[model samples]
Target: MAIVKLSATERRRASAFFTCLILALCAWIAITLSNSYDYQVKEVLVFKNSPQKRAFHPLQSDTVTATVKGNGWQMLFSKMNEQNRIIKVDLSKLDSEAYVVVSTQLNAINAEKAVDNEIIAIAPDTLYFDFTNRSDRKVPVQLVKSVNYQQQFTQSGNIVIKPAYVRIIGPSNVIDKIKFWRTDQLTLKNINEDVNTEVNLQAPDEGNVSIYPKTVQVSIPVDEFTEKTIELPVKLVGNVDFYNVKVFPQKVKVTFTTSLNRYADIDEEFFEAQADLNLWRAYGYSSLPVKVTRLPDYCKIVNIEPHNIDFIVKK
Candidate 1:
């Protein structure tokens, strides 16, 4: 072992420096352990085990300020390492009307990792809530979506939704005003094949509302459409007080586009071509435009041959 000798003055200086460091460390620890502070831990309130036949709605506030009493070290570490601090609120067998939670009840609320700290005060010291059992109703669902189809393709059948209705429970004033439930927007482009998708429904913007089965399956039937042409008889419409009235080429060709599934259903009876006598004379034109008023919803008119018809009238 080798020993290096130092002067007495150097040794005293070194000893004094270490002694001061140790004293300062001990004083800091003592001060930290003796001091207590109010730590406001912002924690969300969690509701559990709601009463049967009685539904609870929104709470007045979700987050609460829990003022706790603990030493400086305890409070600082808690604030730094705090995960989700929740105050559990059990609503089983609760009342049906609006109620307020007192401070004494808050003392009973369970909070994890807080046993070392004493909860001295809670800001806004009261929790307000509402509950109801008869404010529920069933309403139909409305699908809201934007869909663009590929060229030459069209919808062949209705847009179908499974579980077409939803059950909603909330305040009577709010639920009664909601006649239909709308789904979230689902956008699809260049869609040529059938669409089968599950979509989420929209939740009400207002508070204290609850909805059951918030999603639905949507099926949109689509297919490639074909063109078809048929000949139909043109009939005169509107009252005719004229002495004589006659139309040339009483038959007209009707052209339209429709899905193949509906091709067989398309017939002359499904269409009507009429020339309004009153409009024909009112316009005083050489020919009257033929108007096709009725057609199957699944079909779109492509063109109508002899779009105008020549007529002769005598009065």
Candidate 2:
């Protein structure tokens, strides 16, 4: 048996080829290691139970802890772009005593290499939350504006409300600040007759509160008035001793104003004028006691022309 030996040149060429292959392999491993080691901690999403129901607010504290794994260069880039470290958690399905598992991944890495093994897991597996029912309450009425009638016309009666208060329900924090609902408009314009209408209650412009009874019925009375003059006839009451006594302008006239709806019911018979006879007895006047009769029930006297007249007596 005989073994064939390679020439010196052939052996050297083979060795050089083997050495180049080893160097290339080493370079490839180094590059892979460098790329895989570049990564950063982006953000840690915490699922905390909010004090309110069905409401979400941004967490103010930026102190988030997360375990991130990625290429070294990618991690450095995440540090530069704070958004790359954000962790998002859905709150729509939150419930009392219920926890959810949140899986996060790296984003916004400029590296050409795809992130093969990049993931972050929250400790304790899931976030637990507790939900509660909101409290409800009723608040008193608050008058925000005022109404004034035209001249010669006035508000004759009190303003009436069917339900003076409103019901409010919501989270405790929001319910506490609500005082009362208001009405934007309550008018008393050109109303010759009684008014009965419904008014909507306005909610607070800025708040989380909600009102149950959003509307109320209001009743207002408007009256039309006009001045008038009428004569009131004097009448004698009780017998008077015989004497020569003259009563001047034996009739008195009164003037007043009232609503047009009630104007037709007004007349001279509604005025009453009376002078006490007993008072005149002190003055030695036998026929001084004069009384006016036939006064209307629904009328008031604004002024009396010739309010009183002197009586002359001769015996």
Candidate 3:
């Protein structure tokens, strides 16, 4: 290629021509985008004002393609807003009819949509439903948790759930088999103290099923735990012959873990140790096994001194 240098006047003229071309392009775009045109947007369909006497399940998908009449700029913005938009169709007519006309509710649907975008039509214009008898039942709420506690600290008491049950109203055939509803995952990390919070219930899988009071209050009792030891007399059990049996080492130290706050509350009275004498008669064993049968709530037995006891039988 040969290098050619242009005069200053020629360079200015070339620059002016290119700028005019760019201006014309932008003007054309503005003109084209200002005109009204019809466009399409897909929206999720939800039914409201449902018929109370009957439960229904839609035979088709929850999505419907909507034809919208708007200017090009409106189309651009409507499309951007389309991602989270949902169209609520009225199901009141389903009380007597088996199908619903989505277009009949276009005015109501457009009311919730962008003001400039008018919904003119919807594909699959008629929605069919499968109907069944309506029913309701109460089911317990099960909590799902993923908790990581700090070292030497953990949940010390029972977890309490407020409104432990929820009433589910839905198709009889579907709701009859549901045993319980699950709450959303309760997640915690490095928790060293009590938890008092609210968790939403998991969304019902069946669209026809509705749960009342979607959230439940959750309380998790947490604390730091330390070991405590106490001595208690071992009571004899399974003495079928009513014979007086003497057990060596009448008392044993019970070592267990308890939350710091409840350490003093749990003592000899809260614990009971028992030795079953049936082993001597059942299997000719010389010693009886000792077990701490009763323990205070939230306490774990760590060690029982003298797991076995020597016994002497007297008639």
Candidate 4:
């Protein structure tokens, strides 16, 4: 090579060009290293606090979302198998009140590939535990619906339930709110015979609690029958001016329909069947009075078919 001398200005220009080239090469190397091995978000770890000690209500689950950081290569690999990236925290380590930071080492992951990880904060960060045991109670059953007989009918005897009570268990604060569990409302307005129904149990005002038996079987004993005519004691009311006027058929017949259970109790002493003889009084007659009598106390009036009767009287 021939020795070439450079002027001061040209030498400075050449030095600047070399410095620029070296800086560019160092920048390229640094960028390549950063893209290849630098730390970045990868997989996230999540956990629930005090799962064994606290009672979770319905729809409560322990799983939570976590945000992870790692290298681009590691993040790409984790994203390919996203389902496997979830870290499950061991509940056995939970005790007392403390912030449990998820350990990246404990996670079932490639340590050489993982760059960074974080725990996602969730509601109820701290959990409280009471070691006291609880006792279950059997609540008495109640009727939720109105018990009514058909029109002109009456109910008799005791209403019965297959199982008189249901069992309930929960925290005392929750269970104490419940008084009596009742079955769904039943309609008996048109029912004339024994009714058997499956009724759902009521929760009352208890929160986050449930009954052992959600439903109950109820049996309503009923009967339907027609009324029979019976003679009753007669009492005269409202005197008439019909002397020597004798009324015929002093006891009038009255009929109705009711349940058989109540039919046995029916008698002539329950109702008032009467006849008016005042017409005879206007015909110059005296000592004539209307005769009214009561039927049996045990009988119920379903319908008074042809309730009135004609009475023949002579003066």
Predicted model with the maximum TM-score: 3
TM-score of predicted model 4?
A: 0.36
C-alpha lDDT of all candidate models, in order: 0.79, 0.57, 0.90, 0.53
For model 1, residues 1-315, the per-residue Cα lDDT tens digits are 999898999999999999999999999988977798877788776666655566556656777788877888777677565564667765653665455553666556644445577667766666666665448899998999999999999787778998899998777777888899999998999999999999999977754677789899999999889999999888887646754878878989989998988888878988998888877566666787898888876678999998988888776
Q: What TM-score quantifies how close candidate 2 is to the native fold?
A: 0.33
Per-model TM values vs. the true structure: 0.64, 0.33, 0.85, 0.36
Better of 3 and 4 by TM-score: 3
**Tens-digit per-residue lDDT, 1-315, candidate 4:** 999999999999999999999999998866654563433333433343333443323222334443443444454565566655554443444344333433423444334323354333333333223332343688898977776666544444456776898987656666676687778777666665667888887654432344678888887666555566555433343446454433444554456554576666766656675544554444644333333345343344444323343444444
In model 4, which range of ten residues has the least summed lDDT?
Answer: 123-132
Q: Write the per-residue lDDT of candidate 3 for residues 1-315, one digit (tens) a residue.
A: 998899999999999999999999999999999999998888899889999889999999999888888898988787568565788899999999999988888888888764657889999999999999999889999999999989888888889999999999999989999999999999999999999999999998888889998999999999999999999899998899999889999998889999999988888988899998888888898988889999866788999898888989999
The 10-residue segment of model 1 with minimum total lDDT is 93-102
- How close to the true structure is residue 226 of candidate 1, measured as C-alpha lDDT? 97
What's the C-alpha lDDT at position 216 in model 1?
A: 95
Q: Could you tell me the C-alpha RMSD of candidate 1 in Å? A: 7.6
Between prediction 1 and prediction 2, which has the larger TM-score? 1
Number of clashing residue pairs, candidate 2:
13
